[model samples]
Target chain A: MVHAESSTFAEGLTKEEVYTQVLEQASALLEGERNWVCNLSNASSLLYHALLSLPRPSSGVNWCGFYVVDTINPSQLILGPFQGHVACQQIPLGKGVCGTAAKEGKTQVVEDVEKFPGHIACDSRSKSEIVVPILQAGKVVAIIDIDCAELAGFDEVDQKHLEGFARIIAEGSDF
Target chain B: MVHAESSTFAEGLTKEEVYTQVLEQASALLEGERNWVCNLSNASSLLYHALLSLPRPSSGVNWCGFYVVDTINPSQLILGPFQGHVACQQIPLGKGVCGTAAKEGKTQVVEDVEKFPGHIACDSRSKSEIVVPILQAGKVVAIIDIDCAELAGFDEVDQKHLEGFARIIAEGSDF
Candidate 1:
């Protein structure tokens, strides 16, 4: 699979088409690439570039990245490969959106960060966020974190697709 | 002071001018930002974007990122924030470009990764490499590592300027 092609997603593709392509691209990029660090690194870039190829109003995501449970300190999540501004390094379980998702073992779709209680403002420019936890053996091992500068940047379509994206990473990689 | 401006770099800027802008931008982004993770995260993106804005021939850097000395495993360097393909996660002290720079408390500039003995081939696309160790209190705390796809990608100009870039992060941020 040639994952490094210039045009991973064709122009004029519908939003859904773009996402399906992202999933296929994710699979191809992660195929036989089992190292957790390497997998997450590539996946983050894959999503970042995927969004960059999409049309405007759906393309300007400010950040796309991951936060993994720190094996050294299980009580916290440490920053992994990310695109966009600098992010919070460690988020305690149940603290911010990433933390809350990790603690609850679920996905968090924040239409606006300002309204989210106890939001950790790592980057003031991030107005919206979506976080999906990646589980291995029923234990949450990491969270796929994405942030956007626009309000209501994510919805059910994003939630559904990204959950699938995270699932591919969780099931395929050796976390 | 607005660091998010569209054209962060002015046109017709020399390589020296571009590096100076990078240094200044690092300061602006790090001002009052004490979190080492946040500082390094933004710094890596800043340099990545800075290189992208430079003249074409000077802007083909394949990777720009950091590797920190793993506190849990003091003898090893763990992957940190990066822009590029997936990289090797654990690099032992006194090994490879990043580890050698960390162990010796100096910079390692490799015109070719193939010729460097024991060079860990994390990203096969990275042909040239430069690793600058970040020191705090006479001890290497972390390293600023960059890779390029082209041969002899980095030179004395990058060395001197990036050493200064690493110094600002070390002295300005609370690691």
Candidate 2:
């Protein structure tokens, strides 16, 4: 109940399972030693762990990342934290999904990555994505993003759950 | 002595006075009623307080602000917690002093706003400028900037102190 019950190879899981898993994982990490210093990291590891707690593990997302705008390099988003393949690190702010979202302060859900413009294919198997902007006050501060190896993987349910996680991040960490 | 004695304005304040003031402020705000949150505002307020902490009252710095790369808007840096008149709310990543420093990853000093191309004029009264990008994991996250009403007002000493304040902020806040 504290995690997504299904795996990528299996069918999806129930929503309750997904929620329990996500909360349990986050609570553990937040209560752990690294929770305080974890922000110093690329920060993707924490988000990945949180996602793993979902009940529908078969949503098939294996890669996750957090992107922050580089104040020194205003034209790019510096990769903050991630748990996945080596991605296109210096993403142009207005170009890729990450960049465009960061550029406009909006959320982007791509059902198919291949069809997206300037899609940086860091992972050839990633077929779907859900990117949400972490907002502070009225502006965007960073993004919590996930990528799946399955097609049509993420849904409204995923969005709602992940958004819940994003709120926690916005409240707890300076991402 | 940790921070107060080392400050350039140390001569005007006794250690006891400094300790009493800080303790009083901390107790009044942190423990009593939580007024320090009002004290610990954005760069504009922090910088203003820092000036008050100095030996002489400061003027000329008619405006102060922070430019952070917008997490949602990747191609531009959005304005954040700051003081002064209404500022250019957005600066392109590769363009002006704020943008160029962010793009090039360095501290930028502009002796005259008129001399800097693509200089954004939120207030025509602002002349000289200084910008320092705060970085985390080799990535720029924010900029601490000050604009003066006079030319050639900022230098290495100012950079060091302002950077010191920026360090406190970079380490103190969540994001």
Which has the greatest lDDT?
Answer: 1
User: Residues B1-175, candidate 1, lDDT per residue (tens digit)?
Assistant: 2234422567778888899888987777777646566567668877877776776445778778888787767998776677765455578999988889999999999999999998887767778989999999888989998888777888899899999998899998765
How many angstroms is residue B49 displaced in model 2 relative to the true structure, after the best TM-score fit? 49
lDDT of each: 0.79, 0.58
Chain B TM-score, one value per candidate, order as shown: 0.93, 0.73
**Overall local distance difference test of candidate 2:** 0.58
For model 1, residues A34-92, the per-residue Cα lDDT tens digits are 66665676677778767767775557688888888877689988777777655566788
Candidate 1 chain A, poorest ten consecutive residues by summed lDDT? A1-10
Instruction: Score every model by TM-score.
Output: 0.68, 0.43
Docking class of 1: incorrect
What is the two-chain DockQ of model 2? 0.01
lDDT of 2 by residue, B1-175 (tens): 0121221233366433543443333222222111111112223433544444534223477556567776766787765544443345467898888998888778898889899988877667778888888776678877877888778656666676666555555554445
Off by over 4 Å in 1: A1-43, A50-62, A66-81, A85-157, A164-175, B1-3
**iRMS per model in Å:** 5.9, 19.6
For A11-89, candidate 2 gives per-residue lDDT tens digits of: 2546656555654455543432222123312134434544554544433766676766666667876555444433444
